[model samples]
Target: MEELMFCYQCEQTIGGKGCTKAGNCGKDAEVAALQDLLVYQLKGIGFLGNEILKQGKNIDKEISKFVQDACFSTLTNVNFDPERFVEYLNKSQKIKENLKTLLGNVPANAPECVNYTIPASKDEMLKDAKKAGIMYDQNLDMNIRSLRETLIYGLKGMAAYAHHAHVLGFYDNDVDNFFYKAFASTIDNKLSVDDLFNLIMEFGKVNLKCMELLDKANTQTYGNPVPTPVLITKKKGPFIIVSGHDLKDLHELLIQTEGKGINIYTHGEMLPAHGYPELKRFKHLIGNYGGAWQNQQNEFDNIPGCILMTTNCLQKPRDSYKDRIFTTSIVGWPDVQHIREIDGKKDFTPIINKALELGGFTEDEPEKTILVGFGHNTVLSLADKILDAVKKGQIRHFFLIGGCDGARPGRNYYTEIAQKAPKDTIILTLACGKYRFNKLDFGSIGEFPRLLDVGQCNDSYSAIKIAQGLADALGCGINDLPLSLILSWYEQKAVCILLTLLSLGIKNIYLGPTLPAFISPDVLQVLIDKFNIKPISTADAELKTILG
Candidate 1:
């Protein structure tokens, strides 16, 4: 018998509640437990880093990368292969041991290693979990539990962004210290909901700095983005579709396939490639191939191209398309091809050759085109014009209605908000969240499209830049601008983005599609009082509240 595994990381598990038998996520109990162990070990390392920081020692880039990788390994769909999971666990242990040596002290070690040959039964694992970490006390009330989980989840998101930034050679000491502090707090016995709430807001603040760092790295390296149009049709030749959030991998693929006759199409969060000047300059960069990440299974079925996934948001592969999928960076599955460590600038010749072998569409298919490239640079370049229009009452409100999208039924609220919004308003969006309404014909305002896609979730950095620039253009603070942020969050990246918003003291923001399951009432109230945060209501109610 295939031993059952239990998990409940997402909204669409086995039930709306959680996965009790096998993980609705397709993770077995053993893998789930190991992931938890990995998180626990990370918390221990975080504690070590915190101690070192208080002693006035700074963590180096190598240690910071290890910490961030630990957090990322626990993401919903990142690592499912048993061997990879074990490798991740062993690496985390090695890092922890190395950190201990660097600090000249030893902290707590993980529980006894599990016997992989004879898997521990679910009951045994559950019992072992009771002694896991600082946040494991059953006596703690709901408020405390909720607050700790909230911070952990927020950290999980921050770690993901941190990992991506690390990939591009970016690091922040203060951000790294806070990560340790927060992780240590979860294990601290003295923490309260009030304490955790303050920490939650602090998480937001640090995320701002992190996002800003990534923005600088990206724009400085790739040049500021400009407006461009992307096509939605497959060409009748050899091609490759690169998805996910890592631009380094995409840059390498573009370089390797320079004259190989293999066209490259950006998919999922990558569709915004139309914006960046450096990436957009690639003539063979071609256009987009499909819709949001969720629909990729069907889109890839019988598709004649090689697909390179560089990060999260991968679904189970179909047999027809399995052999064609290639993953790099930390993204991995049990039986898929994974490319590790670039041998001098990442030769994507393997992926390019696969594309040529598969060919592509038999005929030049009619394509659907959409306008993109609305990053901070593009928006700031038009700031004077936008401000002039706003002053003339030509442009009234700005709605930042963007976030992650799941199979949740309540997500229609975004569509309604966009449709019911005032005619003079602009809808700025990023990430998978925009899929709810990106196809809508909101018409253009002056020379700009009514609905603008800045980039992926990390590109929320672009939205922040545009907001701050607009504020400066109008000689006001961001909060004083005619902008209302209605954000929908479904995963860790959303959590980190929310933290960045709060960190900036940008208040009166509305968040929803259902608030996080990890926040207790006391913790939630703290956020409400400090940030004026509120759960999203119906379009009629929220619009009245924001516009009335």
Candidate 2:
């Protein structure tokens, strides 16, 4: 039998033993092999890009953008088309060749990764990719392999956020440069485990910077997100459902669909779009339609309008509504209509016309509201009140339950944690993970609501800011405060966030559904010993332990 693809980059990897046949996220062996080949070529690009930077020369701006997009394409559920990977591989080679001409004659025996080449045909590429997987690293130390994989995964997450910010016209030189450095280091066999571990920590610092850049881009482009109650039910009219995390796409869609008699509803991470002042100003930008990305097929089944996917977390559309589903940016599927940007503007008329033809729902559904937009600014505005509540013993503890939501069976722990928390405890959530309990009422503690939605996973920077602010206001270290991080991770983005937390020396984080399969036993022990990170147990049991 032919060797199957090996992918263990996500939380839902098959049996926690790597996906030998196909990925759980609908990626087949061919796509997975292409992704691995893409990463290998990206290492070469990073090497050349970094060398050019060291010589005080500026690489093409498009090189940075290409690096960001290529890394993002390799992320879980982002791109599955082998043809796209072939295109990326060809582009990477051209970029590397251009950089090489600029750098005159160099050492003849330079690193092999710096001069990596793509095969002439797709068949040759696949044959070569069979030997170029994550396990291809010939390092004898398992710990070294673990740290290297961790760095690669973290960089992939950073690339996604950076790409979003880049599209919104935000660029950070340090953040972009670090990507090249991280990618190049992954192929450097001379680096010791300790050296690689320090680089891994640096990946966390840069990821935090990337997330901060995205936060700035998001807030500046679309004004700061404010506290707003979003309607959860449908209105009787033509409507379009926008999913994924790209605010710019949603912003464009809202503008194009306005006054066209079409209502726009957000789904998954896009739910937080309703709180931005610029986005919410459009009257037709109605409300959110579904829970999280995991429920897209069921929620969208036989839906009456068009659906636009803007980023990752997109599942294969069911045939029942596949024709109405449209994808943009790096998202693609076999037969769905993909809308691309012409000049600088994206024509959403296709999605709009589809919505108009479908005629949406026959009658207005009953009103249901869920509060969102409690970002760092909004939360800090209430700092005095929150601090006073804590001083007065009204708000006992703060529980931050956030990260990507998944379809795994054990994910209900998040919902149960929200349900069982004491009335005085504040539960702050972000990303689609909050969907598990965002609709459930937790009542208010003093003047502050017991549950606060802090935008998307990118707004994790907001959560970190809130924690630091609270720590400063109380004259204590963040770890010494009455705050606990209970995160449910599902993909590479979550890996970056976890590294950010660990980099800050934050301890006692509760993570589930299970620890990453990528972390070797020794590496896991190191994390446990240094940070006290623990796997989640039953909600009641974990709550008792945390409260005590």
Candidate 3:
């Protein structure tokens, strides 16, 4: 009865407990171990990097970027290539040793992770990785383990946001510094639940700042998203479908593929790209083609054109179309072609050629329209109208049912909740979870769309701004507003967003389809007692409870 790997970070983890034999996301034991070892190596670098910082020494920005992207690579379904993780491990080894040498002499009480080194043999390295995993120390207190894993998961999510922002030439020292603080804390033996809780909340606030930095990077670099309607039909000719959440990649592809006779369709989280004025300006940039990330397998099956996985949420590619899919940035799958950035730019020649060879659809399909580009700017611009509608009793409530989605059963709660919500209520959503009910015709509430797609999960900041704007207009506290947050989480990104919400003192969030297994009973109770975090019940029941 040995465990292959233990991961409870994502909501769809096996049995609502942990993925032991293999990850539900298609990562096997080997990839999981390598990722564990890679994260452990990053910690060594972080520990010494923090020590060097304490001594007023300077570390290269490359090191910071390395940590960010490496941690990101370990996120759910981002990188499944064991060889890529091995390269990361070897790279961090030199960085860690260089930092220790620079420090000259270190404290005797430094944690073992600070001095940890990768094994020469792959077999031995996998064995050692098991020891570095979440359940390595069985004797560790359940509550402490719970909080520690929670913090680690939040950091993973934080690393994702910071990585995307960093790619856009945006950096926050406070956000970067916390990486060291939180990672080094994983080794400290004396921290209590309260200390970890405080750190977790602090991470939430920093993540908020990170989210804002990314928002600026995106909007300032491109343009504030406008209310745009996009076509969802397949058009004739060569085409490329961009997936994941990296806008820069999409921008580059849009630029390169223009006038190349290839239509560009976005998949999954990239559907929001249609709202960015700069991106959508390309006439060849057609509409979105697929639903959420979980549906990519069937959606991309031997289809025309190619897929570019720029950031994360990559599942195992089926053999039917594996050769046509390319990974860039931190996303990698074994044997798939990886596009590398040279001089801060990626060339899309290979993917473009593959897409061209595929020749796309033989003829144009019928077009259907869906509305996007409803960022905070767009929503708040109509503040007067919304307030007037509210005063006239035209709008009853606001439901912010948003977050990542997965293959977990009972996730239809989000769909049913949106369907069951009163017509007078508006269902605001962001991230891929919106795909559940986004296509359904909810009609319009006067000038506003019934379902507001507020960009990606990274744009959760937009949601926050929208909520605070409404609260301000109504002259009431955020919790007092007629808004409910029923979220369905899948990965670490959702984890950090949840932490961000809780840190703002927001309460009564109904989180499902199941709570994280990493949360001990005691820790869960604390969250319930302090924040009133409720597990989601039936959509109808919860809807009735919220209204009546």
Candidate 4:
């Protein structure tokens, strides 16, 4: 049989041997091949775009948006439709072709990526994609290949954030230029391993900027997140469930559904929407209904309302609820009704009508509330009290257990850690990983809550700021503080965040549920030796080791 597509970009690849026949995330060979082709064409566009920038010429804003969308579309589980990938690939080729004309002749020594041509048909594209799989670099030096792949994955995460921020009317020329530079560098075979390693670090720095841009966009548009309690139960009424990371979509949905008797509930990463003042003002905006993205297959299986996915971490819909699933932005699944904007407005009437038809729960389900929006500003506001508690032995340590959540069995370790943490310890959590234990009551340590939610994955910026504030206030290095970072990673976003941490010279981080499959043994040793990053063992043992 012909060799199948290979993809191991996420934490869970089949047996760590790469997904040869089908992705563990429900992506088949066809979608995988098309995604690979899309990435290749993106690189071609990046090469041309970068060359234009080097000449001090401004690249078109639309081209930058195209690159960002294409990169985001290739993220795990975001888009499984082959046709969507084909469309992105063709658009990328058109951008590159247009740039070539405007920028004049190319150098004879240019890399093959700069001269690459898009296949004219879907059949031809699939045939060409076979040669573009990530495994094509397998024969290269192991260390060099590892660094290159790391940089590429980091760029993917950065692109996702940049795209989100761009949609919200925020744009940074430095961030956009770095995307082109990083993409162009990936195809340059002449770069030494050390060069690629430096590029990886540089990408980390730019990723920090990207995250900061997103943080500003979110805060300025929605107001600084304040600590708010979000209900985990559904109300009795027509309701719509909004999932993913797009606050803009949630805001719009809340506006359109207001006073229409259709309640709005947050799901997955959208849970934090309740903390923003602009969003919480909507009376019909109810609370969250589900946990992390991985739990959606079961949580959304028979939901009584329409669900709208606005970004990444979306799984293939089951037949039971597929009819009620609506996708927007770069997210796409075959047969699902996709909502798009025309004249700068999105008509959510179909989703709203579906919710009214379902008639929601018979009565309000009584449930516990989870606290969210303990971002840096909110956390630091209580810093003086927290410091007093720590000095008085009321608070012993701070554990930052945050990152992406996945379906692997070991993910239970996060829940176990949260449960097993002593009462004297305060937990700082972020991203979707908090869902594992956020619903539980950890009680309080003096005036400070035991658990603090710091927004989404990008809010790692806030977590870092909080840590630095503590370090500065105490007049000690960050390493000397009584803090432990036990993070769980499953996607490129997590990878970029980890790189940012390491780039800041932070050490002794505990990473789990498993290490990335792309890290070679030698590369892993470099990380282990330099940063003291360790894979998590049993929660009890790990906790003892950390506290001791």
Candidate 5:
């Protein structure tokens, strides 16, 4: 078979190499090519945006947002509509032209990406896309190519974080500006490996700030998440299952569905929405319905309620429920209904009507509950108690086992690690990755549950804070504390968070189910040598080593 596209940014890419025919996430050749073209154009915009900045000019916030949303849409599983990528390709061209004009004296010798004419039609764009992908540079140094792809993937993740914060009215100029600088650097032929490595390290600190901004945006608007128990059971009557990471979408849905005989339950990352006081206040905002994104196919199969995906982590829908599943924000599928905002607001009346038409579970499922809302605020407030436990020898260690979850084999290493850890150890987790063992009965150690879920993946800030707070309280470096990190990554957001951790000099992280294929052997050795990062082994073996 002829090769169509190449992508290896996610953990589950084919054979731990690159996906060549179609994305493992269900995107086809045409859509894949268009996304490649969109990214190629984004780099061009970044190139010109940086040029404008060099002359002490301010690019409009809208341009920054365009760059942000464009990068985010190209992320794994975010958007698969060929037409949408065509739109993005065209829009990016217009933006690049506008930036070039703003810069005034554009060099005729600028990179081909910066000076190329964009094809107008979808057919033309797809043709161009085939030649615009990362693999096009057959002559580039392998290690350099590795670093460049790493940098771009990390930027994609950071853009996702920034976009989330932006939705909640939070803006950080440094974060936005860094996007231009970083994306522009990906096209630089003169940067050495060390230079790229150093720039990538700086991104860690920047992404930390980005996550902090998102934390503030969420807490200030929704109030601090408190320890709240969310049902894992279904309720009778009409209900809507909200998936992905966008709370504002869920909040708006909650408002629109109230008093309409509909229940709103969270699925996947939206499970954390139940912990927010402002959002949970809506009584119709019932609880969570599913485990993680990977399970949505069977989980939603023939389920009575409609599904609403607000962001990424959307698998190709099954024929049974595809019509009932609606997308909003940047998430897309070929034929699924998409809810776009009208003048900065979305109307969920169609979604509401879908729920009414489908009707929900025929009978109330058996009641089961899991706890959430363990953000930094909640965890920090209990630091004194945690410190007391540690001092008294009641707690032996801390293991942070979380990240993006996927359907690939071998992820159960997380569940085994969580289950086999010493009885005296405390487990801290965040992200949908927690679903691997979240339902297990790991009883508490005095006042704290053995498992502390620190909200969504973005709330990784909370875990960092908790670690830092413990370090300060104990008067030692974060690495000096008795903590180990076991992470399972699936997408770009995980990549950015990993960069943030490595930048902070956090070490000895156990990463699996497989190392990213983009990291060349040379670069992987550098990371291992510098930080002592290790690929995960069997769960029991890793546990014995970690606890030993």
Candidate 6:
């Protein structure tokens, strides 16, 4: 058999077997190598950026854009197109060159970016690529390697979000500078796990600023989100389902198709659309399409409508629905229609026409409703009711059982934790992992439902807001409150969200579904010693630990 699929990113990747050739999710050798190269280049630039910052020089917007572009490009399921990968590499290299010249110094010409098929004489390329990838300690023990991987992966996720925020005109110099420092430090063999772990926490801290920028971008641009229910039934005409995570793209589409016959439905992480005010205001903006990210292939197969992916979490499309897919921004799949950015605004008229031509479901299907619209504003508005419930002994605890999910059987642990959580404890979740139990009716403690679905993966910002709000209401610090965070991570976004939590100095977080492959042992120990990070064990055991 030809070796085309191999990957080590998420758990349950091909029988938990290391993907030695190609990723099962359509990632090939070229994409993998380029992603690694982009990461390494970011590290090199990041290190250099830190030096500039040390000398009291702030990297200019052009330089920062390159760093952000590198991070955003490497996010899982984002830039899978080879051509685009090359484009990003050239742009990144130019930024590095420009930055070096701007600072009156010069670094060597970067090696060629990684390509799909290895060249005949790849010894130098392979060596450079591997070195750039920043392997930690061929001489170190296993644990340090794992911990370093975890922290690095988390930063990758943070970088993606930070990049998005940066694009929206929000830039934090401290955060930007740290990006360089962290990437540069990875290349240094003298660094200890303690140093890396501290960096991990720093990643979390900077991520908060990044997330805050996004939260502002979304809320200010879209108005504070309110509770709005979404319907599962497709209206009786042609429509489109837009997946991935770009709110600006969604808003533009809503504007582009304002009076058209096409309707818009959200899918995967995009399900939280029903909660945003500006998006919900669109008359044609209908409800959600499928369940979570994992079900996209089955859900979209043979469906008559078009699918527009604005960001990551795209699986390889089946032939049945291949013709129906369109991608914009960083999300790409081979041979799919890509909506390009024009004059800083994406014109999606083509997408709308395609959806109309495809037509929709054969009939007005039976409508099913899924509850949503429980964003931070909605939760905070009910603070009095929640506080009253607690006073009346109607509520006992709060559990933020949220994060990305994977195919690993161990992921069932999240479901168990949510299922076994005290009946009086409220479960606040975001990202695709909520699919494990989002449909469960745990009954409300007073008027508050047992589970609150806060928008998409990026909406982890909402959960943090709620946690801080509750802490303020009780006149105590966030950690002192009776709130527990049980996170299950699968991808880089999860890594960033975890970092934001750590940056806040939030401790005793329980994380699982297998610690990251990138974290080194020494890093893990530092996390354990400093912040009491624990792996997810049995739900019963973990629940007891959280409660006690």
Query: After superposition, which runs of candidate 1 have C-alpha atoms over 4 Å from their true positions?
Result: 1-17, 107-136, 342-345
Q: Please list the residue runs of candidate 5 whose C-alpha ends up more than 4 Å from where it truly belongs after superposition.
A: none
lDDT score, candidate 5: 0.90
Q: Which candidate is the best by TM-score?
A: 5
Worst 10 residues of 3 by lDDT: 42-51
Ranking by lDDT: 5, 3, 2, 4, 1, 6
lDDT of each: 0.77, 0.88, 0.89, 0.87, 0.90, 0.75
Show the lowest summed lDDT stretch of 10 residues, model 2. Answer: 104-113
lDDT of candidate 6 over 131-200, digit per residue (tens): 4443323575555455555656666676667666665677777766777777766656567766766767
RMSD for all candidates, in order, please. Answer: 3.6, 1.3, 1.2, 1.3, 0.9, 3.7
Clashing pairs in 1: 5-29, 204-499, 205-503
Per-residue lDDT over 1-548 for candidate 2, one digit per residue giving the tens place of the 0 to 100 score: 74578999998899986998889998889889989988888887777777777889887778889998999999998887788788988888888788788776544765776777887899888988865797775555888888889999998889889999999999999999998888878778799988988888888888888989999999998888999999999899888988889999998887888789998999888988988999999999899998889888899999999999998888878999998999899887767898987887899888888889999988998899999999999999889889999999999999999898998899999999999999989999998789999999899976788999998887889999999999999999999999989999999999999999888889999999988999999989988999999999999999999897
| Tens digit of per-residue lDDT, candidate 3, span 255-346 | 89878888989988898889988988899888899899999899999998899999888999999999999999899999999999898778
- When 3 and 4 are scored with lDDT, the better candidate is 3
lDDT of 2: 0.88
Q: Estimate each model's TM-score.
A: 0.91, 0.98, 0.98, 0.98, 0.99, 0.90
**TM-score, cand. 6:** 0.90
Cα shift from native, residue 416, model 6 (Å):
4.0
Q: Can you write out model 4's per-residue Cα lDDT over 346-394, one digit (the tens) per residue?
A: 9999999998998888897877788899988888888888888889989
State candidate 1's TM-score: 0.91
- Give residue 519's error in model 2 in angstroms: 0.8
